[model samples]
Target chain A: MTSLWPIERIGFYEGQASAFYNVSAIERDYFEMWYFDNLGAYKSAAHGNLEGVEQGHRKMEAALESIGNKAREIRDISETERKAGIEPEPSGLWQTGAYTDYNREHN
Target chain B: MAAAVIYRIRYIVCLLSMLSLAVHTALANEIPAQGPFTDSECVSCHSDRNPELIRQWRNGPHDPASGVGCSSCHGSLHADANVKARKNQGCTNCHEGPASHSYSKSKHGVLNRIEAHEQDWRKPLKSGNYRAPGSAYCHLHDGDHDDTMSADRGPEVRQWICVGCHSPRYVREQFANGRRQLDIADLKLTEGKQLIASAANSQTKELSKLRQSLIYHRRNVLYGVGHQSPDYQWWHGQPALDGDLIRIRDAIE
Candidate 1:
């Protein structure tokens, strides 16, 4: 019979995959939505609405500043969890993108 | 006199185009001619037949204000709307920009580039169905047809859409943090702007460099924040803005 009390599971934690997955997605969507919204505004300004063009550009900048920090925060938290050896479920979010620094400091 | 003649011709061209569109629409709506959808005929016929599509459109960001109709996105061809939506060509017809570069940088884009055909696209455009939210999912409100762009307004109104995949609390917290960071970046921008204005010599190469630095800061802010791109914000965003401020101050000196 297989022992239910499994010790020293893969990836240092049982839920590591899930926690990483959520963090990966959170960072990614933050970037993706920003891309989508930024383009939408550019298209709007390009099509017309020159009056709001300057403000529109400023708003886009503000959003980037905000999202970049958010992504970093998420990455750091996940890294901390990894260090702590706390695990999540067994799903995965593709750890990609330079913005999220997903590959930073990994063994 | 030559300019006046050109203006006159342009005015006549506009009038004729409007007249042709009006005639085309009138025939489509009144004559009940059965063929490919011409103008607003899809809406006219579907208003009674389907009603839901029309209702969704009426409530969405498009329709009367956007001047976009069924034919605009779905095209005049008698193809399936679901099939048309699986790809982004319909939305991209009008919403073009450099956002693709950001998307391509993402792993999602990289994955799609390699194995997009592996996706079960026939499953329809909805939240739980697709591996990820495509352009239609975001813009069309998960097949709502209302064209509700929740992300445009911000997280307060549309975090529900994200709740499909993420915890609401996590998303809200991220949005709040993002807002705060943006405020801080704006302050940096204000300082840079003042420095640029106060600089004594506007025509000097130093002043020109300052002007160029300000533009870069704006670009960094947008690319950095909008894409959540650490490559931009960490390397080029806050740090670059700090660098720009240094550049501006040096120029003033």
Candidate 2:
């Protein structure tokens, strides 16, 4: 009778994945800058810049932790809903008349 | 009026807190990472644990005053008690100049293809071949790191390092052969110069110059200096140059 999955859960997971992607992008940039620093040019400034990047990394780690916590909360709530025999509502995109018609035409 | 004053005081306190936080963040970013280990810590631990190595390092040219410590050559990133990480690049990192440049071209450098950063020192000695001396063996022979005495003595000290692989007799023989070569080079240079003087044509002038250069080449002075081999300098180098000059002169005549 009740839906286990929240409509917003997909967006929440997407947001978490995006945060991780951002962290990966930042890490790649940090590594590149670190290699450039090792080449002996802009040595002093590069050191300071690396320190800044490390701080940014810590911030990203905190954000990831926050996202992880949110994911756990969602999981717990979904588990509770599942135990109650509530089925997840179908996605609106899949349930749409246009999607059904497209599938029919492809078939 | 009292409420207004209290509100203003709270605003000022909040502003100060924010300013402090900004300053702290800026300071954190500006500070470089203090390496995991300090020189004093390294010395203190190794002094008793590896007394011999510590003693060698202490006596050697790479004292703390020289701005070179254990980590300067060995690197600080390695785990504690990791001596195998010591590299030749550590020497070249600071000693990059003509002398170091020449060493790279010397027989030792060419044969070993001396990469300062390579961990070849850790490998067991290759049998049946002259394992050309690396920077470590040459400078730190028998744990006599004190180069102050050696520096004053010059190439003689280097000769001591050389004798580890090359016997005194062998060196003497090589020197004798080198002298003979020098004589030959001189005779040719002298004859060439005589021929050039007689003709004085552009072709003869060029030939004379080539002969003179050949004489210089025979001297092997730069090669000796680069190798830090005194025998090579006097017996092989200077005499060879002098001989080449004679040879060119003779050739011209």
Candidate 3:
């Protein structure tokens, strides 16, 4: 594979992999951003449903934390493979994403 | 002496023939993989010719902080009459899980993926042009550029796309409510930020938890509002901002 000069194709792949993992976690977490309106946090001040709010808050916090974990997984997996100095198997890349994309240039 | 000169000429001719064959072989191998290559090469020229695309790719959901270039989805075959990337297949190729699990599972996704034949993907992502939405319909739908005409931001971004199926009244109300929810969330986030910034022992382990919670969850807050919601179900999103804000308050005080 011919890595195009200056595109940082490996970096691009890392980013895509991280994004997919991140999105995957979001789906897994069920943290729907589109729907739902004000309730827990606003009412927490009045001592209304404080326990439920706290639990929801904690769950949301954990879900948010997973995005970072997903990104780290991509780097850890690829960095190990990259040290082997072998190319990603030809069919590895995807639109949801893959571990690497650019061709390693042969000078 | 004449015989010696003739022998040297023949040897030189033999060497030139071998060199020519090697050069021809190399070129044959080169053209098929690279120019015929799709993704990054698409950017090389487009970067110069259409910088805005580079901008969108860099800033939008598809690329996020990473890069998913033209050929990644579009493929290598470019010509006057066809742009396969414009089709949903272009997006679905890589989005088997992300779109497939989410939008592809939705009615809109099903109609676009399953029903709407002859949808003319080559046409812009305009509402009537498509039977139902695809990945680009709302996200990449400014046709050519995301912020084209310096267009309105936020929910109004999809007005043109939605107007065909929905009433103007419903659209206006939805945007109004959506904007209100976002404003409240943004204000709460600001409150949390201000409190954290003024806190004592900013670098301590105790504070780091609050900081991490606030910062990381803040991204979720933004994305939560910004992402496509299937039902836009009532009240599910507001509590997240509330929870983070409340956590910030308790930690700071």
Q: Top DockQ: which candidate number?
A: 1
Q: Write the per-residue lDDT of candidate 1 for residues B142-231, one digit (tens) a residue.
A: 567774554456655456665666688876765555554455456556666665666576668877776777666656655554444545
lDDT of 1 by residue, A5-95 (tens): 6555321121111121223333434443455456657776888976556655677677677777866886897899899998855521122
Ranking by DockQ: 1, 3, 2
What is the DockQ for all candidates, taken in turn? 0.02, 0.00, 0.01
Candidate 3 chain A weakest lDDT stretch, 10 residues: A94-103
> Which regions of candidate 3 fall more than 4 Å away from where they truly are?
A1-107, B1-68, B79-84, B87-124, B145-157, B215-236, B250-253
Q: Give the best candidate by TM-score.
A: 1
Chain B only: TM-score of model 1: 0.62
lDDT of 2 by residue, B87-188 (tens): 445567787754565566667776556443453455432222236665545665543545522556675565555565788776555544444444444443
TM-score, one value per model: 0.48, 0.36, 0.45
lDDT of 3 by residue, B78-99 (tens): 5421346556676677766423
Worst 10 residues of 3 chain B by lDDT: B228-237
Model 2 spans with C-alpha error above 4 angstroms? A1-107, B1-36, B77-86, B114-119, B124-130, B142-144, B148-160, B173-223, B226-253
